[model samples]
Target: MQARTVFITGASRGIGAALARGLAADGHRVALAARDGDALVELAAETGGLAVPLDVTDGAALPAAVAAAEAALGPIEVLINNAGVSGSAPLARTDDALWARTLAVNLEAPFRLCRAVVPGMVERGFGRVIFIASNAGLTGYAYTSAYCASKHGVIGLCRALAVELARSGVTVNAICPGFVDTPMAQAAVDTIARTTGRDPAQARQALERLSPQRRLIEPAEVVHAVRSLLPEAARGINGHALALDGGQTLY
Candidate 1:
């Protein structure tokens, strides 16, 4: 792949950081964004990318962040909407605050960033918009009504924008991964351990078992999926939710 300016959110750690490193290694100039300024700076230094400390849910800050990224690198050719949060709660306990916050980070933030960047992409006649959504987006889960709803909305947004931009040379797609090995996954394991009095190992194994492979998906695996979408050959694969879940959900 030719070198391109890539902007990635939630790049401080986990899959975002992994993607930043992978893209940089593949000769792309990357702009890393996340709330953790220190981690972002460290990763940027390691990858020789620009670090833009940002909270994606902050609507006012997004444009400035994109501008700073463009100033440091160039017009973003690949926009990776990877910043997200996860929570699990019963429907009766899913209050308005939880629903709104989940939707804001998981769905609305990506919408805002896509709105900010897609115009330039359409003008340039080439761009890639990839959202790191969850398997919950494709199917429902118990005790996660808000998270499921938000991810479903994200997939919806991806399809809607993909069709709108179909002839504009911009492909919008979502990568739905199941239980990746990240700090977020570890935190979920800890929560399960605390709630069910299971050993940390047991809790983690239980979560891993959700996949037919009976393991946590690695960050490198997710990075590979992102890399696959960067080439000209992938232009035909627009508006699709590519699942990386080891056949956990066969939709």
Candidate 2:
């Protein structure tokens, strides 16, 4: 694959960091974004990529972030909307703030980022947009109404953009993974242990069991999926949601 400029959000740790390393190793110029400025600096240095530190929820700052990325690395050819937030609460306990915050980070921010970068992509006649959504986007889960709704919206956005840009040589798609083994998943494990009085190991196993493979998806697995969609051969994959959950959601 030719080394194209790639812009990634939530790149301070976990899957986002893994993607920076993997894609940089593949010789792509990367621009890392996240709220953790220090971590982003460290990863940027390690990967020789630019670190744009900011919260994705701040819609007003997204355009400038894209401009900084472009000025540093040239026009972005691949955009990975990997930043997300997950909150679990019963329907009645789910507050308006939690619901709004979830949508802001998981759904609306991606929409804004797409708005900021996609025009240039369409003008260039080549681009890739990949959203790191969750299996909850496709199916419901108990006590996670907010998270599920946000992810479902992400997949919806992905499909809409894919079809809209299909004839323009751009492809938009989503990777829906079931409980990846990351800090995010660890947070869920901690929550389970705290709320249900289960051991951390037990809580983790409960999450792993959700997948038929009885394991959490690895970050490298997600990087591989994102890389798969970058090649010219994948232009035909527009508007599709690729499930990386070990058959957790079968068609």
Candidate 3:
């Protein structure tokens, strides 16, 4: 397979950073984009990925960032729309501000990235678009109305894009990970502990139990799943959601 430029959002840390390193190591030129300029520079230097620090929610900056990556690494053949946020609040308590921000960051941002990149990918006749969704997208999780809505929206976006690009040789898919062991998961654990008066360890363990496998997934595990969807042959894998939760949503 010829090496192609891979542009990923949320590339500063967690699964995003892992994917950046993994793809770069696999001979693809990777471009990292996120809010933290310093982290972007650090990881780009370490993994030989280009750092394009910008907020995914910022629509104005996205085109320029893509242009920069194209100028540096050639046309992007793969786009990992992995940037997302989990803002937790009960449905009754979810305000417009919180809801809007979650949608903007998690759903709207990826949509913008896809629109910007897919045109080029369609022209090139080969591309991969991977969305990092959540198990929350598949089913309802308590106290996550805004987050659930945004993630579900992401799944919808992926399906629609896959159909629109079916014959264009570009694949669009989502990775739905449940309770991955990342800083975000730890924060969720802390929130559960404080809200429910449970011990942090117990709350964390309870989250792990939501999965049929009864454990938090490793970031690298999700990264590997992402790897499978990013290859050129994955065009047939479009509109599918790979659950990285060890069967958490099997029910």
Query: What does candidate 1's lDDT look like per residue over 1-35, in tens digits?
Result: 78989999999999999999999999999999999
| Per-candidate RMSD, Å | 1.0, 0.9, 1.1
Model 2, runs deviating above 4 Å = none
Give the runs in model 1 whose Cα sits over 4 Å from its true position: none
Candidate 3 structure quality by residue, lDDT tens digits, 144-170: 899998999999999999999999999
**What's the TM-score of every candidate structure?**
0.98, 0.98, 0.97
Give the Cα lDDT of each candidate: 0.94, 0.94, 0.89
Mark the regions of model 3 whose C-alpha exceeds 4 Å error after superposition. none
TM-score of 3: 0.97
Superposing every Cα of model 1 onto the true structure, what RMSD results? 1.0
The positional error of residue 124 in candidate 2, measured at the CA in angstroms, is 0.6
- Pull out the clashing pairs in model 3: none
* Candidate 2 colliding pairs: none
> Cα miss at 76, model 1 (Å)?
0.6
lDDT minimum window of 10 residues, candidate 2: 242-251
